[model samples]
Target: MRKKTNSAIRRWMYAMAYTAVSAVVLAGCGNGGNEPAAGDGKLTVTATTGMIADAAAEVGGEHAEVTGLMGSGVDPHLYKASQGDIKKLDNADIIFYNGLHLEGKMAEMFEKMEDKKPTVAVARDLPESALRTDPSGAHDPHIWFDVENWISATEVIRDTFIEKDPANEGDYRAQADAYIAELKKLDDYAAEQIASIPEASRVLVTAHDAFGYFGDAYGIKVMGLQGISTASEYGSKDVSALRDFLVQNQIKAVFVESSVPKKSIEAVIEGASKMGHEVAIGGELFSDALGKAGTSEGTYIGMVKHNVDTIVSALK
Candidate 1:
């Protein structure tokens, strides 16, 4: 199942409202429960997305097994559990998901099934002051975009795992310590790289509002053509307004998200051109999904680093 991390084999889905990279074909049935590993009695930990699953597995260490119902590049904000995913949730002993309305499609489902399993919203435990607020009560859910914010959530996740599986408390703590240290390294590295870019060019423009944490932490301005989630449609007025921003600021680059469609951004660029401004497409940013499975960008740390490097290089 392990492979070199890079671009995935998933077909690039370009729908009217969103685009995404979904390639993971989960082998075992969500509830089909074949058998647990020889020693790792399947703890049946459920996560809302692959990124959360990756973190849980790293933090959970050998004490537990985790499952992510949503595959890579699938937007959590727009995710809805499939029939099989519902089965997985029904069978799970514990569930972990990014709160703050990140799981928009599954929010109600999670709420309705809350009593069935011990659910932990990783982002919910963070201090209200630390969160990225939006017009809606829910804050930005992509805490993982910023290493320090993610570290805070990691501590919460570790505690929750320990509470769920007290037998492996020590193991959980050890892994959490190691993972947290690595996260700190990532934070430092990101800061250093970003410093190379001139402060004026540090702005980041993407198709969706996915990098509020990144903006808050890195001293960069994050502007999105669409609102917080892709669920809301962008109108001509929004596109024209963004075009004016690009021309007024003379922004050099605008980014297209891996999961969000490029049409709206194209519209912005075109409008800016008519206004006599220049804008180009930056490299694809992994806003919602990591790279492949094994590569540097495939891991959470790698994902953030890739973003940092890409942004700094482009803006600088």
Candidate 2:
């Protein structure tokens, strides 16, 4: 586990204690509860990442008000929850997060919140066979890179919504079906686009190992300077190694992630240039987060499409 700063540890402790007390107070209230607390009559959903938030909003439709804790370019692996985030989780009818330690710093807090509300790790229930294991045999948490995996996550959200708000079961199911259909289309599009690149050039090198599932599903070889989680640091040796691999493989372009610093990839590019093999920054890919709101890449589908398009344009 990543070590938390003292201030972060203190904040987490305070949030946990505060939520425990709030849960008790809520349970003790005489009012027959378990219903939406929002005056707008929508289930208040707090999700850890933008992708999970998008899934909740799509599945919950008009019956849910979703808030994402981490926004574009925010790295969840290193993200620590704030007091305001604790309030959001405490007030939410349901809390959704990508499991498998993606939110490594906030995992303990989420576990504690489960006693108070329906705190769910949307990717927690995915089959073990579908996940990619790191060197330490830990499951990679960036399942959103694979459209099929995300489709499963969307269904998990739908089922949870139906269970918590049975009155909206039909709406949740119908909306999820529609959204899943769109994801199916996305999966097909990714396969087709990625297949267009020459097999020899079908290698994806990124700032981190967030695309194992993407490469597995779409037939591309993936390499990353950093480990599965961004919490794992890459050293000068790592950069030099990746630089050598890019040169030997004759890879023209390597991608950067929106949530990670560009310096690591820039170093690789420079090293490759020094070796007389130029490597271009393909484009920024949305790995742990999506694009800014209101932009095409802001939505989950848009994000996946943007990644596929960028990869194809650069390498094809």
Candidate 3:
């Protein structure tokens, strides 16, 4: 699990981030923001998760240095901060994180630092009307999964990045324009492909709650055992509740997230079996993190496409 940390150090000789990472697998760290004597003049940008980091990279290109707080297959809800992470936050010029309770443990910290930095909530940029709501609160925070929502959110990111670093304003705008075009193509392709699935079979059931946005935008009915945050556990009572639904609704298949454990989902499966409802584990879906670096499901666009393709194929 910790094997990849050294590889990134070979790329960046500045800081060893593994010591601060609670999750064994981490992305990258470097001599970012400022130097000890003379600041590197590079703008220090911090994102709470890999998805946000990837988006910033797409928009900022090489104009900025971003730190992804979460690593491979790590859940953002239960993330804990380390001493080095605190130092990174202290040095940050701007911060981008998924709001709407996605960062359950870090909400207070982000809120406290809001006045100190230009902290933007990418998911919150989507129109409230376009958001999917539940008893929990505002709406789903996984808006990045849907291309249209992401297109809107990217505007927020691009604008915020420009506001912080105006010297390379033109470059950031150009990148945003190009990236937005790609995002539009992504949305169009998702609509065309997901539409092919029969409407009746478009029910998506997952281990935890993250797909509300995907289902709302793509015409699938979503169900999950836990709430939006992974901080909550799937207790015996919770498992019993979802298992009962699976049996009654005759859900075709269930899903397990790549970042979240398979056990919670496996219990759902086991419950179904005991109740005589034989539901298959549809396929491993990329929820929080992007897939392996070079796979078809690696990029944000590809990962979502792969997920939609898998869900449609399994159900329809």
CA-only RMSD, every prediction = 9.4, 4.6, 7.9
Q: Itemize residue pairs with steric clashes in candidate 2.
A: none
| Candidate 3 error regions (>4 Å) | 1-41, 294-296
117-167: candidate 1 lDDT, tens digit per residue: 467788876787887767867567788888887887888888887766677
Q: Please report the candidate that would top TM-score against the real structure.
A: 2
Candidate 3 residue-wise lDDT, 1-316, digit = tens: 4669887767564345533342221222222322311276666788888778778878988777888888668888777777677767666677788887788767777776665567788886677787776685656678787788888778888988787777778988999999999889888887787788788777788888888878777778888877776766679998999899889989879888998888998998998999899999999888877777667676788888889888877887
State in Å the error of residue 160, model 2. Answer: 0.7
Task: Report the C-alpha displacement of residue 49, candidate 1, in angstroms.
Answer: 1.6
lDDT of candidate 2 over 43-123, digit per residue (tens): 888999999999899999999999999999999999987767867776788889999999996888778766666788999
Candidate that beats the other on TM-score, 1 or 2, i.e. the better one = 2
TM-score of each prediction? 0.84, 0.91, 0.82
Q: With candidate 2 superimposed using the best TM-score fit, by how many Å does residue 86's alpha carbon deviate from the native?
A: 0.6
Evaluate model 3: give its lDDT. Answer: 0.77
Give residue 118's error in model 3 in angstroms.
2.0
Predictions ranked by TM-score, top down?
Answer: 2, 1, 3
Model 1, CA-based lDDT: 0.76
* Model 3 residue pairs with clashes: none
